[model samples]
Target: MVHITRGLATALLGFAEEAEPESFSTGLGTTPAREFEVDLGCPPETPIFTHFYHPDAGGSVSAVFGMDFSTPAGRTHGRFVSHPQGRLAVAITDDLHATMLVAVPPWGIDELAAFDRRGARQPLEIVEAEPPLETL
Candidate 1:
């Protein structure tokens, strides 16, 4: 199972809160010590969203979030999603389609909700007292 430290969770939520009124996307990764790291390459004022089209595309895309993972800031990497309504940010791994670790505004890290790749709610297991490699 993928484990997230409480400190990482709090920092992510805090970033989302601070970016309020605008949805944001950033990179997520882990350090050599197994602690999580949030990428800081994207400046706060960067345009948070964009539009593109492909020949294979068939449907419209809305509320799309994207991040650049080309930076060499961390070891194992992923991306961060922050929606406007304090929506859950879904983390995707090679082994799973998506996993959600979410905290609504005014809620603490203890109140995060976990969801499986299939969108089914799952139990959230947090590693206590573990500090993240970096903070927002």
Candidate 2:
């Protein structure tokens, strides 16, 4: 099993939060933009996110996060495949156009969702830069 030192885990998580998104696509396996499991079922007010497991990647983990400006709370979820050793809680941060999942300790999963919701309280890292023009 590939065990990352606690320090490494923390560093990685921090890096994810600060990393700039390449593309803003809301799909999986797509580079540039990262996607998460978002409750697409939500309206343009409240958003809910979910967790997913891939059970592949040779034990390495992967995830997808989504974001919607229509909702006050950004929702996200996706599959996370990990090594057979142990799974950890993921930290989801709003990247405005995308989201980033920081691998926390296994126990962090319990509070991961909660932290995600709270993270939404702050203004997103990016917002609609300009408003649409009105027709005369």
Candidate 3:
């Protein structure tokens, strides 16, 4: 998923640097994610650094499912989802077909569109906060 999203970001933003080749690891041990930091290399088509000038500015997009269907029409559920980690994510289900997160904040959305050189506005829907993870 990270790879695909990374590609999307690059395709849309026109990255100069190649995505840092790294293996995916969801292990439960000491290993941490490196995909999140794929933009700061050399040539400049840095994925992470370029696409996300302020990824943390917005917040994380989270949910139990990928489909972020809104209760109201013409309104994005993202506005309500409490963006944690200062970033957003297009959360998906196990199959990876569905897409809901597309989680991006105001700045990131703007930055991406600008980078595209399309002079387009960023696309973002309201996201409500995700329910608590741990149960009492």
Candidate 4:
């Protein structure tokens, strides 16, 4: 099971709100204890933004970010694998029609792989949990 920290959720929501009408991507990180951390990979004042769109999904815009896990800096944490490229992704439709938050690897990779190889199956469990206030 994978859990999303409230702080991380809040940050994602804020990013979705701020990047509305456009798509964005960035790197994500975690502490030694596995707490989620948003790795902008750049100074906060100047963020490196990338655009992505899904015409098949009703023109939904997405924010995809995180270290490639294959890079030296991404390997510093040693919590994830290099293959499949673990990263955080969020998508929201124009006009606030729909929104989604996607966590790669330990979060959703298994299910996706299964679907790709075998056909279809239940997805991994993702729980929304409140972290200690201090961690906020």
Which candidate achieves the best lDDT against the true structure?
Answer: 1
Output the lDDT of residue 21, model 1: 67
Steric clash pairs (candidate 1): none
Misplaced by over 4 Å in model 2 are: 1-45, 51-97, 109-136
lDDT string for model 2 (22-97, tens) is 2111211111111213222223333222212112322322233332332223232321222122223222322323
Off by over 4 Å in 3: 1-86, 91-97, 105-136
> Order of candidates by TM-score, top first?
1, 4, 2, 3
lDDT of each: 0.45, 0.25, 0.23, 0.28
* Per-model TM-score on C-alpha atoms: 0.48, 0.21, 0.15, 0.31
Q: By the TM-score metric, which is better: model 2 or model 3?
A: 2
> In model 3, how large is the Cα lDDT of residue 87?
35
- Report the C-alpha lDDT of model 3 over 63-123, residue by residue, as the tens digit: 4344322222322111111122233332222112112222223323333221111212234
- The candidate 3 region of ten consecutive residues with least summed lDDT is 23-32
User: What stretches of model 1 exceed 4 Å from their correct place?
Assistant: 30-80, 86-97, 131-136
**Which candidate leads the pack in TM-score?**
1
Rank by lDDT, highest first.
1, 4, 2, 3
Measured with C-alpha atoms, the lDDT of residue 37 in candidate 3 is 34
Error of 3 at 72 (Å): 8.6
State the lDDT at 18 in candidate 3.
20
